[model samples]
Target: MEAWLLLLACLLIPFVVLLIAQRGAGKTKNGSRIPPGPLALPVLGSLLWLRHSSADLEPLLTRLFARHGPVVSLRAGSRLSIYVADRRVAHAALVERGAALADRPPATRALLGESDNTISRANYGPAWRLLRRNLVSETLHPSRVRLFAPARSWVRGVLADKLLRESEQAPPRGVMVVEAFRYAMFCLLVLMCFGERLDEAAVRAIGAAQRDWLMYVARKTSVFLFWPAVTKHLFRGRLKTGFALRRRQKELFLPLIEARRARKDRISRGAGAAAALKADTTFEHSYVDTLLDIKLPDEGGRALTDDEMANLCSEFLTAGTDTTTTALQWIMAELVKNPRIQENLYNEIKATTSGPEEVTEEEVNKMPYLKAVVLEGLRKHPPGHFVLAHKAAEDIEISGYLFPKGATVNFMIADMGRDEREWQKPTEFVPERFLPGGDGEGVDVTGSREIRMMPFGVGRRICAGLGIAMLHLEYFVAVLVKEFEWKEVPGDEVDLAEKTEFTIVMAKPLRARLVPRSRN
Candidate 1:
């Protein structure tokens, strides 16, 4: 009888300890109460519900949101994730109760790798606040972004030259402009990041390396995230490869960064206030410069470390390049599918241009129809299907749904972009719908109220690169339309299917015929 009692005690002890640990996990950060969420299994939590592929994720999330209401919570290990699908609930979590949801989810620390550097990955603290303020005031301020125009123009010219070469050699039907588009976008961002206009050879090498590194990171990241302990020990070689890639990127950027530092130091010694007064046009002001000059609200009175700077640089380049290029490809594919919309956009461009050389930024901005077409493109295909995961900072009741502290919150950017309730004929590619008097006029993108189509996301965590992204999209669309008349190749229709690679990118690359509008 005593032996039997000992066996039962052994089993009960483990179970009791687990129950206490879970209870501890569910409690609010302040130790008040657990946030509301679904039931969890032992170690896995709700991760069993996670789809095998990111492709399956959106539909799964949609169904879950339908069943659970807007804010549904799930626990992975000890961590809780709050999925916020309803715009109103998102508003409550991200806005009215903003402070509570201001902190970033824990996944970011590992994925972004120690972040005092990048504006996007910084936590909701004084350092982040300072970084955000500096980004707004120093670099991405509209006038400052405007200083990037010449670099943009030079890259555009390079793209035009490439397209012209493609036109001369290849049959119109055989041309796939996707690579050209990627190269052009990468060149622009690289120049912005490094402040140097790299020749085609250099640009190609850097772009190729970046692409390989990004793809590897996306493919391998889930393993690292889910089972970090086992994976790190077992997969040390692959772990090193990831770290190697990170190091490669660091090495690539270091020379440029060092050069900038040296130049700044020289200027400081020579002219002092006189040189500092003028914007240095000798070299383009790179994104690195913005990082160097801007002071963060010091953490313990010390500046951010080099590792943080490297991580931040990685984020900037990755965010700007991968997302933008994916978007450009999708936009081009859409134009190919709906030839009439492409023609309409081209006609709008033609009306504004006295001559190809005469078309300027101001002139393009005036083309309301062109702007509408770009807006429609964004609506049809948001770059990120979901905003990168956000987390709850405190226990709060949103729409009667109890959000426990430290729950991961994710919003459906693509789903919101395509919601039938907000958008009329949501599935259709009707560019006209985005016109001033059209159905999309009342659609709020800025998310001053509830989010409508959050292509750039919403609230405090919204993309600082919004203005520059828009400018690039509009500028490229205008230039492409002005230079070539896009048509679907015979026996081909644009495949608008998506694949996830840190962004919702074209499942199939866009192949289209381009007839030079200039030559015609």
Candidate 2:
């Protein structure tokens, strides 16, 4: 009887909350209607539909858009989520009137693990600006990015050597490249974050910790979204697991962070101390180093706490590694499937470079075809189908639909890129479309003006690591193609079918036969 009462209370609480919250939810003060969606049941909202559907939200959303229109709203208990599938509407909301929609939803704080503290999840205001500015200026700026060239080169070598060894081991069946791709990215990002050339065992440990935390948040934390206060007690086991994962992240990261902090302190002491630290260090600057120097004026000029630093470092590692690895896998898979395109890209790389030395950043910039291949890959298989959800700062209307101040609004990133209105053949993998005389020529990915495709997103909330992410993708893809001729394995064909995870990854992890090309 007591258990039944508890379950009844759990169900009733959210219903009552939704009843109170829905008072004026569908209309703005001016009486404009919100985007139309399915008629949500009282208390339950559209969650019944969600419960019945598979993990992937796209198929369900696609059907809803077919019935409702480009903009669709779905209520999950007390929270109202608005999804936009039209490009013009997305452009208007995210670009033309971006400030009105720049804020992150409050629930993101819990869902994304300390969203208020990190640059990606922080609410738009002074805190967000400060964090974003520090990251851009200290780490991602062009001049600063040049400092990490050696790190990228080293990671490239690590990736190439691993792939060559794996190909040698499994010559007939081809090598499963996803794990190699993920590990190589982690190595590069871990170096950039902590400013060390860690042994493979150390790198793997940190990567495992980060991945565990991310996967937990992505899969398990959503249950607590409606009312975390109540669910915390009800789902104590999950809560405990989440805390354990976070603790593991701190254990792995804090040591590296402390080492950098110690180095920073020693360098400040005198020339002798600085020389000693520099002699042992692998790189000059790191994401953690910049983070350590930050003093938040809004927070009494206090330096960030150990927790905040760990969270930021975790973000730095995950953000740089996961999306890049996913995109690289998709891009390489496409090359394997289409041998002609692969040969064309290889020819371009060959023509541009003097010989088969690793393709430098400069030579990569010169190859239009390589740039187009990367662009097409992003457009076709965006790492995340939706950009991190944005909140409507105020009641904002776009294309005649009202988005109330607190509602969560997310743009359909994959839909926008695949919109037949924008591209000639949206589904096909054609890099040439981004070249001159093609529809995508001179397309602005930043979406400052128009948004044909937004893999990195647009407006104030655009990805901070856009420049570096592009460089990594281009450089690695160039090197891989230059070193190997990626071909489809017999009976183990490249499958484009995707399964949603933290990002959309190929359902069948890309297994490709690699033929080592002789250097000229």
Candidate 3:
């Protein structure tokens, strides 16, 4: 009986999709046409898109863009997805008309577990505004970020130690640094999330939980996005696995959250703020602490539930860790591939700092070449190939094409940075372009005015952690250069070939020979 029902639902879905597509097809709002692309079939929107993996989708989309202009529309299942490859169109839609295009498409609640409760996944509304403001002001604020300086220093040591130890152990082949980079980032983000300098064992447990949940969602649960009602019944085992992953995340994170809650309670009871601060050896502010304090006005001044808090913390950890780690790996790989650029950056670092101390954030601010190196990394290889998909909250027309309300829109992040029109030798890793009197001089990455390149996105929905991410990149890159001379292994040269995971990472995880520099 169950198999019969499943077969019947599958048979009915195509007609249902056709009915919806016909209703929206050739529909115009205010004398505007929807972007043109290959016609979507009855149930499967674009057969090429459905058949190709995201890694292979780029070449397919490139051909589609060449044929059907920069802005193209394709239907997949019941959803209309519009991909904008033009920078001007992206700026117009994401910046000039941000509010109309700021919202996120609805996510399957069972797949996400907490629905769209976290900031990134939440719809653009008062709740989003409140959550975003809380993060930017409370934890990610510069003043608050300064409080975590000691934490960054500690993580840097952890990274350096790991690399050094690994290099020693694997003398002939060189060390694979992606896992080290990831672990270091996880350690730092875990500290910020929980406000505890957890032991290595505890950090590894938390990191494993977060990574497991993220990989499951990115790999397994995305299938349920289409016809979730029907697919949920069909893929019950996978659905259960997703839920189990969420449960594992909660199990790892909730204890740390509750501990923070207890600390807050103790301070409230009578510990006194200064004394409480003194008693706790870790950083003063944490993401959890801020979440505990936020009262949702839209939800009648209610505090966030434990599940909601865990999800948010999960977002905070994954957001800072994966993207940053990916970017770091790409940047370091570039350094290994390009020796002259590495030496130039090392010279800049040496000129700025006198001794063998970890590069301070204040000192990193002064190194212009270091900044340029990091900027070029973002342009040449953005962490994410596409920003999170944006939904059209209302009818938004860009370049005379109508992006109707309820349609999903996304910008090609990698395409814009490599555009020949906006950049000179866009494919090359030339950090000097961002130096004074160069093509990319004074380039605003935020895409506030005009988008030369948008690594952290642009406008209202720009990444909340942009400032801190840049800082981490600069500080770590500067110190890493100062501490070691990165060289390509003789047989295994650094390969820039990329594979898309949670972010775009080197398909060959960077393995490079590290020669410790002389301090004296």
lDDT of each: 0.73, 0.87, 0.87
Q: How close is candidate 3 to the true structure, as a TM-score?
A: 0.93
Query: Higher-lDDT candidate among 1 and 2?
Result: 2
Candidate order by TM-score, highest to lowest? Answer: 3, 2, 1
Q: Compose the digit string of candidate 3's lDDT tens values, residues 1-520.
A: 9999999999888877886676576556566788987766665666666577644666878989999999988776668889999999999999999999889987755454565778898888999999999999998999999999999999999999898889779877999998999899999999999898888898888889988877776677666666677788888898788788888889988998998888799889998656656444566778999999989898899999999998899999999999999999999999999999999999899899968777888899999999999999999999998998899998777778989889999999999999999899999999999999889999999999899899998878899999999999999999789989999999999889988677888999999999889732
Q: Candidate 2's residue-wise lDDT over 66-126, tens digit each? A: 9988999987766778999998899999989899999987752373355367898788888
Candidate 1 residue-wise lDDT at 166: 86
Greater-TM-score candidate between 1 and 3: 3
Model 3 / residue 161 / CA error / Å: 1.4
Model 1 agreement with the true structure over 1-520: per-residue lDDT tens digits: 9999999999788866876687666444445444344556566666445544433666766776787665566665656666766777777766677777767765523643444455665568887887777767776788878888887788788888898788678774657777888889888787777677777887777777678777876676655555466666776777677777877777777776777676677676885534533254334477777677755546455655556666666677777777878788888788888888888888888888887583578887889877787788888898887776677776676666667666677887777778788778999989888776777875667686877788887777888788878888888888888888877878877888888776788877887778888567
RMSD of each: 4.0, 4.0, 4.2
How many clashes show up per model? 3, 0, 0
Give me the runs in candidate 3 sitting further than 4 Å from their true place: 1-30, 42-44, 53-55, 109-112, 274-281
Alpha-carbon shift of residue 416 in model 2 (angstroms)? 0.5
**TM-score, prediction 1:** 0.89
